[model samples]
Target: MTHVVGEACIGCKYTDCVALCPVECFHEGPNFLVINPDVCIDCGVCVAECPVEAIFDEKDLPEAQREYVELNLRLAQSWPLITGSKEPMPEADAWAEKSSKREYLVEMV
Candidate 1:
């Protein structure tokens, strides 16, 4: 199964995971990143690269974060593809440790 980008990624938006993805399945939103389920290779390489541990295999996703599967799919279709590394949000370090960030998600670029 494909990997899902969860709430921890909402404001952090670290691109370390994006650079490790062989298929370039990542999509860039205003303040987050999503994996295009159709394009993801399920390589699992991006998992450890994530500073906030936001990436999870579809089958291994936490119960509370399951909705991110659909969120990733939906947003990936509309957001621009992100194939390389980039600076994260200015407050990424602060946001990374904060919980319940889904509400901060931005649907657009």
Candidate 2:
């Protein structure tokens, strides 16, 4: 199964996972990153690379975060692919501990 970027990644937008990804499956939004399910190789590399522990295998996703599977897919279609690591959002550290960040997600770049 594909991996999904969950709500914990919304404001943090850490790109460590992107750098480890073998395929150019990650897409960057204004404040987050998503994996393109169609291009993802089902590799678990990105999941361990995520500092916030926001990436999960689709089958292992928590019920509370299940919506992220669709969200990642939808956003990946419109956002630009991210093949390299970039500095995370300015307040990444501050946002990392904050839960329920779905409301802060920015759909556009």
Per-candidate RMSD, Å = 0.6, 0.7
Stretches of candidate 2 off by over 4 Å are none
The residue pairs that clash in candidate 1, if any, are: none
lDDT of model 2 at residue 27? 95
Please report the TM-score between candidate 2 and the true structure. 0.97
lDDT of each: 0.93, 0.92
Worst 10 residues of 1 by lDDT: 100-109
Q: List the residue pairs that clash in candidate 2.
A: none
The deviation in Å at residue 84 for candidate 2 is 0.3
lDDT of 2 by residue, 1-109 (tens): 7999998898898999998888899999999999999999997988988999999999999999998999999999999988898999999999999998888898876
For candidate 1, give the lDDT.
Answer: 0.93
